[model samples]
Target: MITDDTTVNGVRIGGAEAGSDQGARTIELPSGARAEVRKGYGRDLMRAQRATAGGDANAVVFALIAEVTRVDGRKIVYEDVLEMDLADVMALQAEVIDENFDRPPQRASQASSNQDSQSRS
Candidate 1:
């Protein structure tokens, strides 16, 4: 998601969801540094993604949460964008941008899977 990190003129900020979630996420910042957030959320999902396929999933979990709250005192509402593929999230995120920005946001590519957008975070 191209997160509404487009802070409201100065109040800096920040899905995240608490259930079955997955895929690549883009958290737009005031700065141009590209942020891609990985790792799944939700108990059922955390176990399902099998983030390790076989390794230290706790570490992965820790890092993801760290990034979510790192920007000291930032208050954010989690916006969930469902689907496994990052590309899909990018496209949907673009649409979300369009809704927010008014003009059409760029879509990365065609979806590999046909599904409706789901917002959870």
Candidate 2:
């Protein structure tokens, strides 16, 4: 039963404060079920990439999840698709990848700006 103000681990999802720390965001499905999304750590990403390269969808999905805060309230601290349907799993994967994809561009642009300033100095 996800409300508009749903939160996971005390962080609001779908709000301006979402993804504020540890890349946390709340993912609410139309079925009134919700899950928290977080960016995977380095090893998680590495494993996910490897699994993706090997065409193992299950492993890839598992690698992207950091926690499931809403599903069972069990504080599961890893990818566990046993209770999640395909839609939820896919959504989690997409959110994780999207969050990861967004960071590099900003960093690259910032680096470029720094280099430009140094050159001007």
Candidate 3:
């Protein structure tokens, strides 16, 4: 989990999830930087996984990075990660994904609890 004090490039990064919206988060990096990271709707991640299965390591890495990281209020794409030096930002991107990806939103848990109660009644 990313804490509010987790800093990359001197800026803090944090994690948040609300309702069933998985694609809502805030990412902060160095150099007066901040971004809104969100979960990809699984299509891109599936495509990336397929590429990896086909022996495309580069594709998978960039795909995962792009799927999770956003910058300047825009979704980062494979081309975007390719244009930049991986050494500079890969760790930060990976950290954001590791901390925030693939988790059920808070509302989903609540809804499940509600369903369980109704089922028991």
- Candidate RMSDs in Å, in order, are 18.6, 10.8, 14.2
For model 3, name the residue pairs that clash: 9-30
The sequence of per-residue lDDT tens digits that candidate 1 reaches over residues 76-101 is: 22222221245534443443333323
Off by over 4 Å in 1: 1-22, 42-64, 67-121
By TM-score, who's the top model here? 3
Error of 2 at 96 (Å): 1.3
Off by over 4 Å in 2: 1-21, 46-58, 66-73, 77-79, 100-121
For candidate 3, give the lDDT of residue 84.
69
Ranking by TM-score: 3, 2, 1
Q: Local distance difference test, per candidate?
A: 0.36, 0.56, 0.61
User: Relative to the unseen true structure, what is the C-alpha lDDT of residue 36 in candidate 1, on a scale of 0 to 100?
Assistant: 45
Give all TM-scores, in the order shown.
0.19, 0.45, 0.48
Give lDDT tens digits, candidate 2, residues 21-79. Answer: 56556767545567665554555465456646876766655644643233433334344
RMSD of 3: 14.2
